[model samples]
Target: MTRPIIGRVAPEQWRSTGATAPGQRTVGEPGTARIAVDLLGGDHAPAVVVDGALRAVQDDPSLHLILVGPAEATDAVFAALEPAQRHRITVVLGDSAVRAVAEGRADAVVSAGDTAVTVVSATRALGCWPGVRRPPLAAVLPTATGHLVLLDVGSTVDPDAETLAVHARLGAAYATAVHDVPEPRVGLLTIGTEPGKGDRLRRAMPRRLAGLPRYIGLVEGHDVVLGEAADVVVTDGFTGNVLLKALEASYSRLGGPESTRAAVLLGVKGVVVVCHGAATGADLAGGIAFAADLHRRAAIAAIVTSLSDNPVLTYNEVSHD
Candidate 1:
């Protein structure tokens, strides 16, 4: 595909382009999206991340990447970019890039590094949203019927009922805001759809979700691919992580629609996107775009407001051991 031309959009252009969202502030300027890239996060490290950054910049004129890693990797990215494209990219030397946001450098973060490190660093740098305990990684998969939201894909492996319920709220907000689903359906992903079919956590979560809007009751693993049960599916980090990987593999072998290799970190104050340990340049580009999408939609703020619960209860609900 031909690369999209990059240029700064004017204020009048934003209004004339019909790209404004309802009830959101509109700057008649180009949609500039700043992404923080972990130069050392992926399996391919600086090399693959650089490749992806280059692709993202080339694809979106308003896209800017902040390479977070060694100075050497940042230098490499500059060398690869054309003189003009180089202006769209910046480099920061550090253990993480969340600081870039604090410094007014970046709008979102993307990492293929360790999940735990990313979460902790983000919590320290961006702070957690009210009622956000274990910020889960939420992925959007193209299902047979439409796109589906899967959460805790790799963030909270062993989660409690409260964690799952909070994730449900977060996921529902994401679906409504970013996915544009009206009254999005939320489902608890379990081994079976029957009552008391899943493990202890699943059994307890269905009851908790009853009070929440758009909750559609229990769903099975097959429901994920079918996309008939719910728009948002909640599970513990361990199961969600494993299930996503397995489904990705199956799709690879069986040849299904191209699904994204990135998952968004939900419940954090700042937007963070995570990719698989083994990600391609395309996957990284998608992750960057995903971050941009979330930013444009102001998804996190919308979700947090809808939760209507005390942020402290988010952690208190779960036993973090």
Candidate 2:
């Protein structure tokens, strides 16, 4: 499948992408979180979204939800919560939830929609950080020893070596900022750790990553499962996305995947979380919680501060790899 390139789209055009909605309640309180959710996102959208929204409200007492989608879907959310529970809930009737983030109507945004569409919406809405050509999706998973951070997970499906290198920096910063890991050891995920093995992108990455913080050369798939290899692993979106899905599936079949089902969209200026298309009610709820935590922790701003001095990935022959 051809991946959606991170194009330079105007905010007006980006917000023009439409969905159904008629509006519902509008309320906000102190300590309350305002998250704009794509009502029509995911395979079993409105239903699962409604379930997730309701569950999130139940889980987080200070949480406030902004349901964006069809009027019917928003109504479902209203029906689930009582009059007292409705005080923290608001309704926006549209698929333009990303616009809420851009306009500062909400603190963050969550979607289980098309990865390309969601990425385009957020990047167009919130803009990208300086020197960030491609905004990769970074997912944190539980490893055997500790936790692992994987980048380029379905955001930039086909990125160049430099893009992957940039993602390495972004992923490392993410570990340091959100995961609270100091001096994260970064690794390039490829078929082999041996020098001169794997594809052109993998071969070119070591040199670029060498300049970044705590880079430990190449790492393999098993390294991602075992926390001993590296704290952060960078790969192309195609490989990262495939690996994430396969692992999620395998873990789910055995019992269930990690509690956090959402992948953080890194390299963007605002807080945006992307849940898998197959995400269930619980998974979507987890995404909502994850977004709320990032907002509260100011994860994006913290990551920028952590990577302030790192050299941006420079384009060269690696762009063609």
Candidate 3:
């Protein structure tokens, strides 16, 4: 938290003047997935963001960027790419990049911005799913077995039992749709699996999530790394966010199994990926790629469909706080 978080973008002036590069529409350009990026986000923003955007466009032939920030910051991105390549870039001078997706100007949004700001803007621009007041940021991690999904990494802090239950639904749907797991097992993360081991919120979650057939009882923190316990692990945002950072740091220190340094914001209408505020250029680049991949796979739609089809999930509409 070294850098003070830049103030959230105001609603009326969020949309600013923009520039579009001139060039012929390359093959698949028209149909290419466009991602809106928050250039002013992150601890070392604009510079790191510009670097990430440049890398993303260069690596993917059909990838297009809708960068939102100051003219000076975007100009840097414009300077790096050739005039011909500018056709792939569109600058939207605004802090609310997620608005691009809500407006249908972009397929997805990538931000290393403050979690609360991104969540608020995303929810306002693209309303949450029915009965979902708050969404979870699901981070997919590599584990001993295969992969496990941990949610609420930095989204709803102080989530209620109901919110956590909804995360279970979201995480399970995500595992099924994105991971192609036929029946994604879900576990409530806590200090121990034994009954009455977790905090007040976790202790209350079991009853609400009981209807979920795939609920595989409780899981410890180690389940997140082991992956053998459950495919989806649900926790409150406060704990999830702290644990995620710890795991990332530990992995960095150990130089072990690598996972994308991005988390997908679930329960939203459009694709939104959020990276750590301290993310490096490569990490941000990976996020852009992750957003594009999510859009390509139609992951959100699949999760929605899976959620709708699950009678257990639909029936359990726990009251929101």
Candidate 4:
């Protein structure tokens, strides 16, 4: 069986730095993962961020959080923590959070602010993989059948034909890396399964994605719910995000998965997760866990390797080009 890394932090020196929450100490353990939380990125700002950080520390002994935002908010989080438990938490400025990952200060980043800002900051800070022009956000949804991979959930809204093709490659690689699915089947999301159903972008993708990886023909909205047509489903951000939210709402009404709050930012240099802008403490906690899971599994690195190994077909060389 494939033994995936499920979010274990690395061993590092424990440093209290500067925290005045009574018994504040540092619990730096070997294999401890330090996550940088974006305090001002969510709708609720510092309040939810504070609650989530505390919950994360309480749930995992080896987890540490670098609260990134205004000092006042982070201080509030520290104030609420018991002095002894405070050792596991650190407060970093928001501007420094992305840099912390690039500078080797944090293992992963979770943000719920403007999706565009997070994407830009992460891409600029962490950098995108080679040939990854438009990075896609890949979300994992639990279907009645099984877990499904959906890409471009909130990134690349105005993607071109080439961009959709690139997302297909990234999604397939992600499935192989994280889902451990060999030769992952890819499906292009369209309004209907019939030929020429979607706009120009969708029509152009099938021909390009074919023969690259295990590209299946066009799949409709129902395919995403069924989870049988493809292991990785590709769509533009506008459609994907709306569909995801609608489905999530439906699932909430009918009661599907217990938790659905984590999504990996694919095509970037490092692992990053974008949770719901209105995520609760528990939802944020789930995002943290998901980020950790990706880090341990080396999902992003593995996907990069796969993409490199199997480069996308050049423009001129493509069949319909």
Q: Write the per-residue lDDT of candidate 1 for residues 86-154, one digit (tens) a residue.
A: 566665446677766644556788998888898888887887776677898999987899889999898
Candidates ranked, most accurate by lDDT first: 3, 2, 1, 4
Clashing pairs in 2: 20-69, 20-70
User: Candidate 2 — number of clashing residue pairs?
Assistant: 2
- lDDT of model 3, residue 51: 82
RMSD of each: 8.4, 7.8, 5.7, 7.9
Comparing 1 and 2 by TM-score, which wins? Answer: 2
Assess each prediction's global lDDT (C-alpha) against the native.
Answer: 0.74, 0.77, 0.81, 0.74
- The clash numbers for all candidates, in the given order, read 5, 2, 0, 10
Candidate 1 has its poorest 10 consecutive residues by lDDT at 9-18
Can you write out model 3's per-residue Cα lDDT over 135-175, one digit (the tens) per residue?
89999988888889999898988898888888898899899
Model 4 TM-score is: 0.86
Q: Between candidates 3 and 4, name the one with more favorable lDDT.
A: 3
Comparison by lDDT, 2 against 4, better one: 2
Q: Give the number of the best model, judged by TM-score.
A: 3
Per-residue lDDT of 175-262 in model 2, one digit per residue for the tens?
9888888789998898876899999878877888887658899899989887798999899999998998888777778884364878
* lDDT over C-alpha atoms for residue 15 of model 1: 12
**TM accuracy, model 3:** 0.88
lDDT per residue (tens digit) for residues 79-155 in model 4? 56675665777664345356557666777888877888888988998987666777898898887688789988988
